[model samples]
Target: MKKYLLQSIRLTAVLLVLLCVVYPLIVAFAGGFSKGNGGGEKITKNGKVVGYALIGQNFSKPEYFWGRPSAVGYNAAGSGGSNKGPSNEEYLAVVSGRIDTLLKYHPYLKKADIPADMVTASGSGLDPNISEQAAIIQIKRVAANRGLTDRAVAELVVKNTEGPLLGMFGPSVINVLKLNLALDELKK
Candidate 1:
């Protein structure tokens, strides 16, 4: 029993160091090798940092493409979803409000044409990407507002659309911030 007790203590100590200490150090080191060198990828424009590539930013103007609805109002520190299920009255009401607001801005969009992501907040409430369909749906309004051709804006959306992981998994997505940045560059 004493030998077993000693073995248990050794195992616990070893695992604690491996998991609690060494693991984090390795992860941090690996992150340093990544794009932002352990920090998030900063998206810069006109020699100024606009936002992070991995986080969402609120863009309400008609000329800018809209991103997913954020439950936390795009507050990164307060990132979270509404936690209400589809059947929840409050959740439905919130979705309804979003739909109404979207319609007000995009009078040409049919209810069915609105992508689900456009009206629903992602789990993180900081999703920087939206479905290609979501981006495409806003092309007309965005083009009209920016005084650009629909074809031009649609081409921009196509240019910014990212394929699924490894070209074979998940639906295509568009980083809304990146797309909007490209749009601004187009005007230049």
Candidate 2:
């Protein structure tokens, strides 16, 4: 029993150094090679920082494309989903409300045309990208609101559409912030 106790103590100490100290250092070092060098990749507008590339921001204006609804209100500090299942009344109502808002904004869309990502908050509640279909659905409203031709806005959407990883994995998605930024650039 004494030998077992010493083994456990040594194991705990080693794990503490490996998991708590070494692991974090390795991750931070790896992150330094990424876009923002251990911080988030920030986008700038007119020399002013706008938003992070990996986190979603709320864009409610009719002229801009919307991102996935965020259950955490797009709070990166507390990033999470609602945790309410489909059977939960609160979740259902929230989804219904989102559906109504989308229908109101894009009148031409039928219920079937709406993508699930547009109505449901993502698991992280901070997904910066939405399915391409979600962005396409908003083309008319965004085009009309911005006084730009639908074709032009559609072209921007096409330009902003990012293909799946390595063109082989996952569905194509559009980064809402990037898409809207491109839209603003269109106006200029």
Candidate 3:
């Protein structure tokens, strides 16, 4: 009985070490060395690191397209949604405020023109992209601010748009940082 107990103890310790330490270390190293988008780092032009495509940024100007509503205000450290149910009064109040703000900036936009993604926070507060339709809705305001033709700005939006993952896994989206940087480049 004593010998059997000792064997069991040794087996438990070895398995724990392998599962908790060795397995995690192997995964970490493998992920670090793996290729494919470098964990979604943003590519920039003109030798400057702009922003990560995976994390959202706040763009309040009329000229730049806005990403989804961020629950934590685009804070990566606090990356989570409000978790409020759709029927919650607090959620309704928050959406109402967002709608008011959007209307103030875009008086020409009908209620239907405001995409659902625009008024609701994503599951993560750090979403870095917006639906392609959302970007299209903001094109007129952006063009007016930069004194460019709406058609010209729309072309830039098309240039920055990214299709669904693997061509079908997700909806078409536009990276906010990339689009804004391209807008700045237009002035150069």
Candidate 4:
């Protein structure tokens, strides 16, 4: 029993150093190699930092593609879901309102046709990407509002889509900010 206790204590000490110290250092070092060098990937326009590539922003204009609904109002400092269950009345009402808004902007979209991500906030609440279907559903509205052909707007969506991880895992997603930035750059 005495030997086992000493072994367990030593193992705990080693794990603490590895996990609490070494792991964080490795992660921080790796982050330095990322696009923003431990910060977020900042997207710039007209020599100004417009937004970060990884944080969601609210885009309510009909001409822009809307991102996922945010529970914390897209506040990166307070990233979280609503924590409301599906059956909760408030949650249902919120989703219904989102559906109504989508239908208002996209009269052709049926509630059944809307993607889940379109009406629901992601777990992070600050998800920068939306499913491909969500972007596709708004193509007609965006084209009509921007006076661009549907084909052109659809091309933007395609161009902005980020494929599955290494092309083998997860579904495709579109970064809404990048897509909108590209849209703004399109010749009207």
Q: Order candidates by TM-score, high to low.
A: 1, 2, 3, 4
Candidate 1 lDDT at 54 equals 91
What candidate 2 gets wrong by more than 4 Å, as runs, is: 7-11
lDDT by residue (3-52, candidate 2, tens digit) is: 99999999999999999999999999999999989887999999999999
Score residue 124 of candidate 2 by CA lDDT: 96
lDDT of 1 by residue, 78-184 (tens): 89987888789988988999999989988988999988999888899899999988987899999999899999999999999999899999889899999999999
Report how far residue 49 has shifted in candidate 3, in Å.
3.8
- Give the clashing residue pairs of candidate 4, or none: none
- The sequence of per-residue lDDT tens digits that candidate 4 reaches over residues 1-188 is 99999999999999999999999999999999989899878999999999998889888888899999888889878889989997999889989998998898899987888999999888988899999899999999999998999999999899999999999999998989999999999953
Which stretches in model 1 have alpha-carbon errors above 4 Å? 1-14
**What TM value does model 3 have?**
0.84
- Among the numbered candidates, top TM-score falls to 1
Residue 34 in candidate 2 has what lDDT? Answer: 90
Score each candidate by Cα lDDT. 0.92, 0.92, 0.85, 0.91
Any runs in candidate 3 off by more than 4 Å, and if so which? 1-8, 35-48
Question: Native-vs-model 3 lDDT?
Answer: 0.85
Query: Higher-lDDT candidate among 3 and 4?
Result: 4
Q: Compute each candidate's TM-score over C-alphas.
A: 0.89, 0.88, 0.84, 0.84
Per-residue lDDT, model 3, residue 6, is 100
Query: Which tens-of-lDDT digit does each residue in 145-187 have in candidate 3?
Result: 8899999999999999898889989789888988898898897
